[model samples]
Target: MAIRFESRTVDGVPLLLAFPDSNGAPWPTVFWFHGFGVDSEVHRPELRRIAEAGFLAVGVDAAGHGRRRLPDLQERIDQPHEQALRTMTRLAAQTAAEIPGLVRALADEGIADPDRVALVGVSMGGYLVYRALLEPVALRAAVSILGSPEWPEGDSPHQHLDAFCRTALLSITGERDENVPPDGARALHRRLDEQNPRSVHRYVEIPGAPHLMDGDQWAVVMDEMPRWLERYVLRPAHTTPSE
Candidate 1:
């Protein structure tokens, strides 16, 4: 079935909503976050796949990115690597904090099932997923592609790992990803495993892939991510009767 797409702005946050052609109320939802400098539209294919897998997929424009680019973006764009990292850290944190409210708004509008919410992000979006885990949102699962639990100087990504241990997590990265080193991804998996031995935690390393996935690598993601969410989020919900 072809997925239908719509553009919406909820309380100043620009979003792209995707769902199957069938009329389904309160569909299970996955909030997608794109990489730096990219807009939600760039992820239409992936979001469509997610919607095909029985999810109402949503993609949001990160602050100062995509259509939300600021007028003074050139100055921030020219900043040093560390400075840019700091800026991304702050933005990711702020965006993470706003997600719960956004989810609630979606639920109120009868567009999303709040109880089955999940997150999927790549690169900076992946980093935002990590940050979002720190908050008290009722996220059922999360997939972080080319993301990590490390932050710039003065930031502590570890403190939240324990908090995140309660939710199912899947962290994927390229074996040759220079932007987010493979070692860090491995270490994050190890830490999460150690913190919560009972939770479902899986780490995947795509061989010969880079920070940005090519068509084949993305195909792998398109296949695996929905399966992961189905296992941890959808399947369980299907078996459990609503209160």
Candidate 2:
């Protein structure tokens, strides 16, 4: 079935909302970030499926992609732009400014759990989530698929991974990935474990998954997310049923 599409203004920026009918009322919500590319972040089928799991899914193109109607007020990102280390980092921070609006819109529609929202970002989007939230506390949980964190001035980006994994994050990397490398992911895994140590972090090296996962892997990763949202985001912090 075709996923229904909707749109609205967030801080004067056009953001896209998608959902598939699963007959569930007031689904949880996930703010997803698409990987870097010229591909339209618009109309992503997987993103829309969040609705089918009794949750709403919201996504936006950074100032440049898709609708192209947001304030690109941040410093101009470098070219191939997203490829430029500095540009990507700047764009990630700028995009974070818009998340509040995205959350408000979905909550106002009454299509999502106002308090049970989560974030799932890929590539640049993933990195942005880390840079923006500094932790996954804003939402229920965050799935960062191959997202790398950029270090502060005079620091290597890789050096910041530990401090960056400050949430219930599923840090995934391909065992043979060249872009981020297994060692980098491991370094991140160690830092997250050392910093938070409460098991909020899960590092998985796909037997050989690359920058992006294939169909089977994608399906598995997507399906597992709803459960995570239910446990961490939807369920209240501490409510045990009336005795």
Candidate 3:
């Protein structure tokens, strides 16, 4: 399984892309987001796994992170709780705004099939996934692990449930997560259920899991992500509206 890795700046966003070394233009793509204070390189293994599963997995470094990280990024993150939360939310919003541009760039380069694109993230990255989904960009599926839909600022995901009616979203959270509690996801799921959109949107909580999940819990996450994508994004009949 030969997977080629490339680091490039597309649409002004630093990205680490992994895909099959062999020819197959316009592959199904997953634009993954890394947690706060971390960079895309941390997800190298996950990116490789996604590539082996027949995808052009692109790891995105959210603003104030990775190559774009500001010199005082660590200090800002280490600030008091309320101050840090605000900073993180701002970065999430900025990063989410950049996604549409990156999607257009990827499609133009013929590296990602515009129709088979998905978003996956963890923690603050997961928050980014939800923020991006609120946009007009048409995504086939999304997986948010240990993420939240609430922004605590402008335009939270709860305010735009209708936008997600066409895209399938699977949210995974730890039952014992206090840093970013599962309540946000639980509330969103209940709302989505009420909307009753044809698209699949579900939330899963790992028993006895914490904000920073252990190896066994991660196993469940790794297993569930591929299964969800295979069923919703890789299936031939699965189609999403063009952006």
List all candidate RMSDs to the true structure.
2.6, 4.8, 2.1
lDDT of 2 by residue, 127-233 (tens): 76666555323555667666665433333445555444334666666676665556655777787667656546667667777766688776666666666655665
Estimate every model's Cα lDDT from 0 to 1. Answer: 0.81, 0.61, 0.86
Residue 212 lDDT, candidate 3, scale 0-100: 90
For model 2, what is the alpha-carbon lDDT of residue 196?
54
**Which candidate number maximizes lDDT?**
3
Order the candidate numbers by TM-score, best to worst. Answer: 3, 1, 2
Pairs clashing in candidate 1? none
* Candidate 1 Cα RMSD (Å): 2.6
lDDT per residue for candidate 1 within 1-243, as digits (tens), equals 988899988867889999866677788889999876667999998888888888999998888776787677667757887787777777777778889889899999998988888999898898888888887778888998888778875555655567667678888889988877777668878876676676677888999999877989977877778888887778555442111
Report the candidate with higher lDDT, 2 versus 3.
3
Task: Give the per-residue lDDT digits (tens) of candidate 3, residues 43-108.
Answer: 999899888888899999899898899999999989997788789888988998887888889999
Q: After aligning candidate 3 to the native by TM-score, how far in Å is the CA of 226 from where it should be?
A: 1.1
Per-model TM-score versus the true fold? 0.92, 0.76, 0.95
Candidate 2 TM-score versus the reference: 0.76
